[model samples]
Target: MVWRALRPAFALWIWLAIGLAPLAAQPATEDTEDLLQKAMKAAVARVAPSVVQIETSGGSDILGSGPGMFRKGAGPTTGLVVAADGYVISSAFNFANKPSAIFIAVPGHKERHVAKVVSTDNTRMLTLLKIDAKGLPVPVAAPKKEFRVGQWSMALGRAWAGLDTPPSVTAGIVSALGRIWGKAIQTDAKVSPLNYGGPLVDLQGRVMGVLVPASPRGQDETAGVEWYDSGIGFAIPLEDINAVLPRLKEGQDLKKGLLGIYLKSTDIYSVAPEIASVGIDSAAAKAGIKAGDIIIELNGQAIVRQAQILHILGEKYEGDTVTVKVQRGKEELTFANVRLTGTLSAFIHAYFGVLPVRDDPELGEEIRYVFPKSPAEASGLKPGDRIMKVGLAGSPMQPFSGRDELTQLLDALQPGTELTLEIMRKGAKKPETVKVRLGVMSDEVPEDSLPEPATLKKALAPRKVAPRQGPPIQPGQPGPRPGRPQPGAPRAEEKKEQPKDEKKKAATGLLKRMTPARDHEYWLFVPEDYDPNIAHALLIWLHPAGKNKDKDTEAVLAAWEDLCSENHVIILCPRAESNAGWLGSEVDFVQQVARDVLAEYTIDRQRVIAHGLGIGGQMAYYLAFNARDLVRGAAPIGAALSNQPKDNAANQRLSFFIITGAKDPLAPAIQEGKAKLAEHKFPVVYRELAGSPQYLDAGTLQEMVRWLDSLDRQ
Candidate 1:
């Protein structure tokens, strides 16, 4: 189907090639390869005037690091002319260092011209640059829809220089189309840091796409950079670039458009696109879409699976309107003019200040304890009152949908907002609707909180559990030791198949060490009696500066073994570089390691914790703020807040446990951090220890584990 559409464009390219060079139908020879090289050179020469080399000055080396993909050079990057009036578009990576000055060396221009960032398209990871020059050459954009796999593609970039040559160019075929969720065209041409902002041109020099580092699985700018020069490359379609060029001309940075709906299922491949939760103030909710609605179609495209939705919406930017069709019950509802946004109004989880008991004695949601002076208590509500329904004041009542729904509605509301709660008192014949004003949560830790209840003991006293070991090698398997077969080896046909999860599972033990990269190392501890079927909490420890000491490994194993066994907990200790101190840049390295562990282990999504002591705790705060999707709980002990926490991810709730010693000098900073987080409506449990030591004691560790255990509480 695509080839049929591309026939005209392909035909035009063939005729243009013939006109450019006198060609004859001849037998294939060594000079045929030379003819291909000449064609590539001509294609590059036509676009050479628009290709510019960019250089930066006076910025830290921090921007040199990228997530997922490692980059080799930080010296310079490439750019392309998007307009004749000096508006050039380059990869956002070029200016990521926040350089003090930028200069561009344009083709045919002897001197470099000063350039400044005009706007950024974060959704596509491109930055538009403006210079004082005028009448710059702009290349023609090839029709993206007419692209075909195996089509001749040429990658051009000015990353390096030859004495008399234009930009460096590599030739290959279009490896794939509609890659990066329909955002980019994939080419096997070796793409690297040097040619990132250059053009992927056709045989006739029409721009097909702007070369960039991108991954289908990752949306960030640095995502696919490691594959540079590795026969896998990506480029943002030039047609899409032209469509958003006007917005970039106006200096408005573009961000990925968001619908603000959390899907019900984690398995995107097979699960239908059903909303698990919808932001109360989001476009989906405003359009009258509910949580149970299954997203059946988007922008007229059928959306059968969750991945389909991601692919369709992957490149959409703010202000884009999309038609959404959802199935509610038997009715298919189409919502037109559903506008998307890059940002949402800050959502603060308004608190009612009630701690429900562990178990319910009534049919409805029961409150075990109400905080003193809380909205729940002020509204004349008491312990043992069953909350049967909740709704806005003067509205019809709706059934209470458990703590999660209640929490979501509360989070969607601002402070001091008034709402109604239907409470059924014990032995009461009827329920009463009480008006309650939403309030802020207290940061005060419980004065007398008990260690996680004895359910952990029951879990520890288990009947049976799987032994923590790597997958068993099949009979006759060569395994890591090549050539030598195992005893009683069965041939391939006779071997029993192992479950997919077991086959690729990670190693487990008290201290199983893994090095993800050259300088990256992490240790994971899985209890000997680990149960693969049961979800386990993951506690990632970030030790204080230089605290990745010789003794730290043994100490961690000794300290957490009992707690891990008592409760289903997996401990991960990621080694920081030198422990000299944590840098803000370490966030990527640490996040990468955590992601690896999460992928390999059966981690409880709700109970992931980032616990760091001292300066390490500071880094933990940074990690949690940025890693809102993964780290549900953050425990920063004896450390100041180095960076402010970001607002929660859409529909995500983050809780924190801040610990400080009474006599510690950093106690004041800890207190300040707790107060600030509370102001933002985040749930914070402030724990003050008795001693001045910058570490938690045994009892404190016990309390910490209990807190970690309860993180999954509804």
Candidate 2:
């Protein structure tokens, strides 16, 4: 018996060597190719019986409709039989539209059986369905630990019609393992909507994984579908699905577990896992975990960076219990059996209603501006009042050192919490104590013109003046002017002589033709007196389709020059590849430009915002929702939402400012979008113009600037 097994293994080794031999060393005969082809066919035939054709009709759109939106095809899809008693598993993306009726065509059955969804795994983007049938064929699952890169892999799908037809097959090799936070395996096989829910089998005819689309940046069902057939595909391991098959069959919709803690830095690779804020009533809070605690170990695994914790938590389901060890100050504590929850209470920002002076070095924080009916106003706080100390009711006061400390303290508290503040007026010798209750931050813009923000006293040089080259254009009304270069035309360069006594300064004021990479160019506007010492806010502008020419840049500068200088904000405008519109592929380019600017300039991370008009606004929504770590706020004018808004998270904080005209055609959609965001507990500031207009008027633009100025509000 031993000799018989050894003979079969020796023969397989010879076949592999013949098939993989290089031509230079020795050319393989026709027999090698024929043997490989037959092996792939045999693998397909083994798994084809377990694959079933799935069809649906009359479903509404789950992902919102807009430019570059993902639309599901009308053809049949595929699924795999997971059990012998009529249980099947498929991708959640297949049922994202929530079809009214589902039908499954099983093998060797002449009739289609009606099917119903059993449960869904939102964390893995997989769905389980059941039909009234018995004795179905189930494919064998390959051991995950035995998978290796460069091994032969075949993708099988039953999207073709007729039960008699064989499943379509594509052959390739395993490209990677443990991708997408350890939830997916990477393969080079052709994976798309046709084979999304099918089986990926090995050379031995054992199922390795189930094909699906997934992305690290987004958690939506259709997040990674845009990369279909692009030599990059993802599949969830069959062994993992089999491990959770029992829970799925119990009709429990599994969701990602939440600890409700925000990290101090978004750079998970380099930054230590330091908690910045803990959500109220969350798993962390219930376990007596507080902010400033550094996670040291999770589930008996040593944790060094935030990514490790994410990987451990990514595979955990709601209601799962995990043990956590944290270092609080000089003490190391461990919490046992902390149960994770599916959702946390939405965090509402508590408002103190005062803007502090920028870069003030005084012992206390000085107030710059106080709103008319705010908590500070009610507490008799005025401009120039220095807050010496602060604390909760009946608690010892702590020294108020800087604006950051105060901001963090208030962020961890609730809206109705009462606080006591010790204030020192400008001309007062002693400090006075005042008590006030915190309130919710308002979403409406201030009605009156606000006072300018106060800055630290510094002596500066006089501003430099440049001669005008063309006729003056009115603000907010930049029309085609004479002697100006047309859209997409090369502009003539002009060399000017500089004065001998003039000091060299950084490039400022309308720097054009900035090419960060090949086929990518943008325009930047830096204030005339750009100061590296002062941290400035960065604003990325996305223009409407066919309006990103030279004139558009001029219009933006003419309308926002004064605002940019006054608010200390840097403006960046990235151009799309074509005038047709912005593509989903350009999101990375835009994000790269912003990152380059951040690295080059002293940009405040808390004030980074994305503002766009019309179609460009849709891209803004995409970037803000997908890149939550980079974008702090989104301002979309004359555009509706393109995708469904995700639930608010304690770690990823995002706010919105939506603008639309009262009579504009997209006004209703914008309103509906605002309502959806509000339902998810996102802070939204909405404004409606008096009449229909394609772009923002001068007054409305100033209001937006004011909103940007207050984005760092505590």
Candidate 3:
């Protein structure tokens, strides 16, 4: 969709067309209308009454009702009674910080009853509420897997304080699924503040996902956790509720199994084997596993790749036992029994009293593993082997079934300690179990923790670029040249141009530029008149997410660099950490690198500028807001100012050159941003890109350099 910012008047027309789009795309068949209308009616009737009206009150009330005043009291925003006898579930954020009392109003019930929070789980984004009510028909859970794309669903809530009606219903559908729900079910339902704790009902009147805040939900961004409607709604899934309910209801703390391994799916998008890159010695390694092992099975279950292994490992508890089977070339072996145990999570639970860490793609797999060097080399602790047990780790020989218990044992031992390992080696005639010391592995070192600032000047540091890695060698195939660099390697032409001192300076300059190890996305511009003998100003550009990170960073930075070179500017466009899109971590990385550059480079700090395209533009605004002290000025091309809380650490220093493309979707956001900047009395320059159709067009550079050049720190 080619979109540009439109004025309020133009926005009305745009929305009018959007509102009329469904009517225009109506099905041609009469049966379609009948089925849809019937389904809507029946689904509404079955689930509507069950969807209670949630009203939250917090803090002491004033003498009279007023804005920001607690009319009743302080508590979670709202909740839905999924079970009878007032077993209510609500957003954890709503109930954070010990809400005084929560209020619940069922449909047809005139009186709102007081409820007390039973327990809260931050990882699940859910809180259990107990109320003094009876016979509440807990709605049936809908099948998450059955939720198809474009399937109709409804948001039920007493929106706008029930001023709208008896639970206003807005219709949307399963727009998309498999969202990062953070241990909860994530669905795209049409919900709002009114639907905060409401149920998302499918055609069968079953709860598919729970209604909660969508992205950019922080109040500083929007009121009511951003819009739950507008097709930007999320729901806690029924399946997730099922798993968590057992723990929540029983009051038993939930602790997920930790393997301390980092795994990247070799599957790409299919059933390809996973590659293990980093494995923590405390767990699988202590049990005799190693990096580069292609795990094939768990507990005799024929697991295809890493994700399956993660799924299996995630289910077991701290003391559970399971058998594992792994393929070692032509031979297959089984770790007959392995006891699952806890790792860092167990410590966090006991000490910090924090919630469970949400799963990440890398942490979900076995990045780290244990292997016995002496025995493995002698009896062959091949990389592909999966350790099934370490019987000696436990007294009474409590089975060392899997990575869990083995990890606990390893943690008990000091560093550089040795222990007996019972491993199922590949192609071995028998289970060759031997003892070896847990020595340090090279990969465990942080990739970004390169040589320190001083000594790094001598190292031949290559500027790491964001690109795809080549495929792993096929099974039973030897890797080409495996790690031996040819003698007398030819230097690149760029390298040859520099003198020895200049080369050292280049290396020193390179040392100052460190990128985030995971998902490093950015643009690199070798200036038009760049000299290998002299260092150039590396202006890093960060964009907000709309498409691929690497591509967007490249396009925007290339445009900016081209414009800047006319005025002599060197640009390094860093992509966000997320390959899928912009994430909070990416923003931090850009800012951190900026600090690093300032410490190492002699460039004019007043000339340090951060710019973005669309969301990138938003990020620039955010960076200026966050670290205005570090930033000279910002150029947000297609994005505008953020409405996120000014209380945010970022907003204190926000200064910007707000740019708006004539056809940008966020023109309104931009205009509103400009308005907010004015409200805050923050100094800002506005650049409205007239007739510019999109974000990555010629105007992007024109606006970037124009703004950057205009800045004067003094």
Tens digit per residue, CA lDDT, model 2, 148-221: 88777777777764567668776667889888888888887778888789998897899999988888877867
lDDT of 1 by residue, 1-714 (tens): 432333333222222211234434434343654556576667877888888889888775643211221334666778999999999998876676578999998877878899989899988899999999988999999997779898888788777663146777766678888888878999877777888998999978899989988865445556566566678888999999999999999999999888877665445788677665566577876787766578999999998898889888887898888999988756788999889878665555567776543212122366655667788888998777778766566654555333433454453455676778789897899998899887855544444453333222121111221121232111111112223221111112222233767665446686645564567777878888875545578888888876786588668678788779877788888887765766655677888877777666556556788888876787778678767666878898887764344555434667898888898887887798788887666778887989876567888777777677555332
Instruction: For each candidate in the order shown, give its overall lDDT on alpha carbons.
Output: 0.69, 0.76, 0.46
Residue 95 lDDT, candidate 2, scale 0-100: 90
Residue-pair clashes per candidate: 1, 0, 52
Best by TM-score: 2
The best candidate in terms of lDDT: 2
Better of 1 and 2 by TM-score: 2
After the best TM-score superposition of candidate 1, give how far the Cα of residue 488 lies from its true spot, in angstroms: 44
Runs in model 2 lying further than 4 Å from the true structure: 1-34, 61-63, 66-68, 361-363, 457-504, 649-653
In candidate 2, clashing pairs total 0
Compute each candidate's TM-score over C-alphas.
0.71, 0.86, 0.47
Tens digits of per-residue lDDT for model 3 on 1-714? Answer: 001111111111111101212332232344554455466567656765666655555543431111111232232244566677778777664543344656777666668877776765443456777778888877788876677766666766544434223345566556676543232334444455545666777767787867765442232212235243344677767667766776677665444444544333223235434333223443554554433344677776677655566556644555566665554444555655565545431111000000111111111111122222323344434443434434233311122212222232332233244445454455666754555544321111111211111011211233222121232122221112222221111123322334456634432211113365644544345445543322223465665465544454455554555555454455656655554445443556777666555443333333567766655666665566555446646766776554432421111123466667766666776787777665544456666766654564454445445444323210
